[model samples]
Target chain A: MLREVVVLGVGMHRFGKFPETSLRELAGEAGRRALKDAGVLPRQIQAAYFANALAGLLTGQESIRGQVALREVGVAGVPIVNVENACAGGATAFHQAVLAVGSGSCDVALAVGAEKMFVGDTGRTIQALAASADVELTHDMGLQFTAIYAMRIQKRLASGALTLRHLAEVTVKSHRHGCLNPYAQHQKEVTAEEVLASRPIAGPITLLMCSSVSDGAAAAVVCSAEAARGAPQPLVRVLASELRSGAFRSGAGEELSTAARTVRAAYEQAGVGPEEIDLVECHDATAPGELLYYEDLGFCKPGEAGRLLDEGATTIGGRIPFNPSGGLTSRGHPVGATGLAQIAEAVWQLRGQAGPRQVQGARVALTQNSGGWLEGDSAAGAAHLFAV
Target chain B: MTQGVFRSSTDGEGAPSLAGSRCRYCARVSFPARPICPWCGREDTEPVAVGRRGTIQASAVVYHAPIGFTAPYIVALVELAEGPVVFCPITGCLPDENAVPPGTPVELVVAPARAGGAPVFQFRPLGG
Candidate 1:
């Protein structure tokens, strides 16, 4: 009943502190690159979804963000929709684009995510990031996202499910991958001693183990299968795309974590399981997050994520590689831009175009991007499966 | 303190009691008191006081603070005896020391959120 959707092209601007770059410029560059890669003009795009989380709070560009940014890249005269879902905005936009094409509404759609966090004021950016949580209850609580992750890690550490060594090791791996990624913000590899000795942000999390505030943009072009008949690039099918919101979880209940629930739905939609995944681009905002998601994404059972890391299973050459683009910790988390950046990485690897970080023989790739925090879970969780 | 989050003690000498609502239809309880139950979308709910004593489920000493907050403060998620978790600052504990470990019993108290700021509810290690 529904048409098949495929990703035609993807593009990204490097992630780092680009104080001289404007939001429009950042978005326009990525959008233009995606169009060029797809061999399509801006006018060919029937609908556009622009994702930016902090522009309203950080840059004061409240409404019509999509229209304003896309117009600079000759993306006018199209129905542009703005999306904001904290860190998962880009994936949300992509999900909408896929739906648009699959529902027979449009043949070509575009999703773009961009953020400029180096606004010459660090305090304001931190303040805006904190607004992603329940402001009513946590405004006065001095809530930092690092602290939330630190708390979770502390509990696991106490239970002996993880160790300080595991945290440092995963960070080392992230940086090692980042060193091969030209777009990564922190490409220099770090030693375990250096990671442990670095400045502590919260609990056991060090400065090197966390993602930095970055400025960047990423974009993707989606089209119906018929539109991709003779495309220059290899066909990349959208096997599944799912987006879910956090439900009320009391922590004591048996309710699965939001990521688990979302990924399960994606697996069902795709008619596949974790064993079929060749590589993954998980939302590892912090070092330990990658280990936790090994279990959350069903790659391993509980209490065995550290073992998966210990076995070097998540490295580029290992089974089920993760964060081949250095992930958020090193790729730089420009918030809204992170999701699309992951998509771009997946597309590259699937097309055998990834220069140094490609997972050999990679075919099926999954991306799990989460955003915000609500009721002790990510407010928005998205899992999209792509195959070549 | 945010309005409708807590109420003054009857004797007016102790910390204000945290408020919540219990649904009559589904019997689900929500903190900060909701007019309607979040579980079943039922408007039949009653305001009730949640327990002030709880155990620290997790705690972290934040070195980087956001605006209006000082660095090196302890923030924690405590599971109240009444079966709800609340996120608040842990008072009466040095940031550098692991004085209040997870599972440590704590009692709610009112303290200034920041220098010269209005008093808000926080937790302190029992008998510390």
Candidate 2:
């Protein structure tokens, strides 16, 4: 049997433009905060797993990023493994650290994700990120992720599965919550009229519907449940942590299966279901991504996401609060740090620490993150269930 | 008879795409570009240029574009003269209407893109 693992502490650097902080420094700051929150010193960390994407291509620093980042905080001689799973890099690192602790390979482990991407020119940076898709198909077609996902939206809408208003509602709702989130990159509340008036980036998705690129870092401390007594008050438990790779039928059109499988695995591990989830933080790189995740995670049936949005089933005070921290749509997607931030958000909700956006009496929370494209679908996915 | 094929590069001697086959065992058409007969998936597959003219299978207008991308572009999936189908963007056409309608005729042209700071191949419309 696997040892039980619990998240002792979590910390996230503010999720916005931070041109003055280097990636290493950003990671160091988050790491230090996580250690402090866990009441553990830097030297007490047995090992560190770092998650970063685009550092090699965008930042000119590739090799040993984990070593450089961790050493900056005066923590050294521990195994520092660098993880690069595109946007899911952070969650993947967290999963690894969970494994390290659950498998009894380490007592105290650090899972930190950091990225510095806001310094570059817009066109170049976007082009580089688009390269993460199916190059052979996307390169010549000029189809970036936004365009590809937009195609899915078009197909769904054309099939009478969704409407433009449904898309607008999600944006409006996210913005409403985002306005209450001080750390959100976008805090202004917008109406559906304003969202509809935004510049279109793809068939149905507008520029305002996409996530902003930002620099940030997030860190988590994982240890056996026995190590949790000394942690801060109101402890939150890591009920389950799971990762699922690309499904064999990914490009065959039913790509949601990957995320579904990951969530299912997490549910099985946590001994719970979507009905028990009071809060969730999902990968909302685009407005539609969040909508689709609702169905994929079993919160609703396929194509019913639009209805869910209109009903406000995902709002902060709704049946299940989703993305209470504003999500990537407004919180900024710092790639590597995004996954960890999702976990942090879940922990905050579970511990009743999410101030204005808190889901009252939230006890069970879920996080779903997918990254990279394989065979025209999500290449990597991770899901976790947390409780208090 | 005159023959044609698609090259990986704009220049000759790049990579040749072949069509049809006359296997020593039995004559048949093998779609994959082969040095030897593809009937056996062996060294006998031959190299040939199947030419450019093709039938459009499907088409869509990309109303939303990626950053650094031209908006309102026409993209299509086409069955080549050789029979192999390819997906490409139909450039130089009206955002509203284009000969790129499904089952319409189309040809290939070279285009530019960014790859590791270098320009790469992108497909464009063939004719007006």
Candidate 3:
């Protein structure tokens, strides 16, 4: 007996480092655009759900971030819920909004994710951000994300399942897609030899293979079908949205499968399969993650992600175009805004508004986001399916 | 200090053994103590030291440095013969793919880490 939720509008400020813009300002811009797109005024939003991770750590504003950010946009006195799920915070907020709409609690809800990540020294800022990781154990082991994932790369290479070229192919393809996306953080493409020649951060992972920190914001307006029909344009129905936590609380096994579970469930709830998906905006925090996800999400068989990349299956023109919005690799992972940005990409394609990166006739779209690291995989995973 | 599970320093057994938590609920184990069962989230658990023995499940040789660490290290997934697979750095030998393959038997050793730093755990060839 779940109520149907429809996306009336999606909005995003171009993704990049915007030091002149405050967190609240960026969020306000996105919110304003979304409201306009939905043909609603500021007074129409019934509630606000804000997703931000490092605002407290980097900005020293711990509590009431949602209140502070949204109140500045002239939407005061409504219930404002702040969600912090690390990198997945944006997607998590969207999930809560979906629940709010699906449960018939609120007819119109605004979900916004924004982060300002370039205010200080980049390295120190990244270290402070890493504070979200399991600090005590990671400190003792002296392991950073690069170190942990580098070990995984080494192990996989040792298995003779992949090569450095395969990893480079991942970067090359992402850059190729980003070339057509003006909003991407890194638009310049690179050759495989250049990737191999780049400096190594951790063993086997190079600077070219890693994503950098930046600032951005994305917002989406969710309302019931009744409300959406009243808006200016046709609506994209939220078919199914599901979130799952890490299977292993400590130490890592089954992380890939954890995301897969949410995908399977979302497909079942949406009554669609891998083949029916037109595009996906997924978490590609690193090159290896994208490959693992291809297999994890059943787009291809296990260990075939490398082959998939080599064969041009994940590019913009592929069977199921992935990360056509440039992905985290090229588009920049601005933490809170990433999930809503994915939704925005899907909405743009559904409405036939994407200028160049659009997947033609995209009717069904999927977004997968993985949050903080737990035992061996992400502690939280979320997936959402939308249909036009 | 030749790192092995030890008593207090004055008692002269070297550094203490790395302690972990074992599930009393359903026999699942976790390295670096977990308060509740990862599988069931139950509070029923006990602290136990995996004895100085295990087999390597996977091994990787590091040619680059980790944060706060030096290069030329070995990281391995070791499965205690009885139960539990743990991630730890292997010392005393370069863990190239050929040096320690999956199922290679290893014996725990106690030793001072990196130029007389804190005593830590490492593994070596059991027969050697």
Q: Say which candidate scores most in TM-score.
A: 1
Candidate 2 on A1-388: residue-level lDDT in tens? 1888888888888888887889988898888888887888888889899999888888778789999998866679989899998899999999999999999898889999998887757666676677676565446456566755665566677668888887888888788888887767889888888888998776678877888888899999888888777677567778888988885431124345678889999999989999999989999888767888888889998878888887878998898878998899988898999999999888878887889888999989898888987543578899988888
For model 2, the local distance difference test gives 0.76
Q: Would you list the rank order by TM-score, best first?
A: 1, 3, 2
* Candidate 1 lDDT over residue span A19-97, tens digit each: 8999999999999999888888889999999999999998999899999999866898878999999999999999999
TM-score for each model: 0.97, 0.84, 0.87
| Best-performing candidate as measured by lDDT | 1
lDDT tens digits, residues A1-388, model 3?
Answer: 1789999988877778888888888888887888888887778888889999988878888899988888655677888899998888898999998889888888899999998888766755666656666654343333356555665666667777788888888877777777787777888888989988988766677777776787888898899887776578778999989888866633334434568887888889899988989998888887666777888788988677778787777888788888888788888888888889888888888888888887888899999987777545677788999998
Stretches of candidate 1 above 4 Å error? B8-14
Residue pairs whose backbone atoms clash in candidate 3: A250-A375, A251-A375, A251-A376, A252-A376, B2-B110, B3-B110, B3-B111, B4-B110
Model 3: runs farther than 4 Å from truth? Answer: A249-256, B1-15, B34-36, B39-43, B51-82, B85-128
Q: After superposition, how far is residue A82 of candidate 3 from its true place, in Å?
A: 1.0
Clashes of 2: 15
The 10-residue segment with the lowest total lDDT in model 2 chain A: A247-256
Candidate 2, DockQ score (0 to 1): 0.22
| Stronger candidate by TM-score (2 vs 3) | 3
